[model samples]
Target: MKLKVDYKKCEKAGECYYNHNALFERTDNGFPKILVEDLTTDALRHEAAEAIEVCPTGAITIEE
Candidate 1:
């Protein structure tokens, strides 16, 4: 699975990083930075999904 982020739609809410710090990180400017681009495990996939759901702007998407 691949994770895609729509920067234009992002609000810099930091919810993604708060929910799943292992998969997402915060940049110096307070935007989200994907720590794991490719979801290779079940745990990672689930975590990514949670991050997507938690994102207020719906900026994150999963590509399978």
Candidate 2:
């Protein structure tokens, strides 16, 4: 599985990057920059889920 973010649905809330920095980074414009595309481990998958749940706009999802 991989973590995917829908840019059109994102509102730059910073929740993904702020809480899940291992998988994301903050762009200069405050948008989230995905640091990992692949959910290579159970840890990563769990982290991605947390990020997705925290996203207010529900922009993050798991791409299987």
CA lDDT of every candidate: 0.90, 0.94
Error of 2 at 13 (Å): 0.5
In candidate 1, the residue pairs with backbone N, CA or C atoms under 3 Å apart (3 or more residues apart, or in different chains) clash, namely none
Q: Model 1: per-residue lDDT, tens digit, 3-61?
A: 88899999999999887899888999988889999999999999988988899998999
TM-scores, all models, native as reference: 0.93, 0.97
Cand. 1 Cα-lDDT: 0.90
By summed lDDT, the worst window of 10 consecutive residues in model 2 runs over 1-10
Best model number under TM-score: 2
RMSD in order of candidates: 0.8, 0.5
TM-score, cand. 2: 0.97
Count residue pairs with overlapping backbones in model 1. 0
- Model 2 Cα RMSD, Å? 0.5
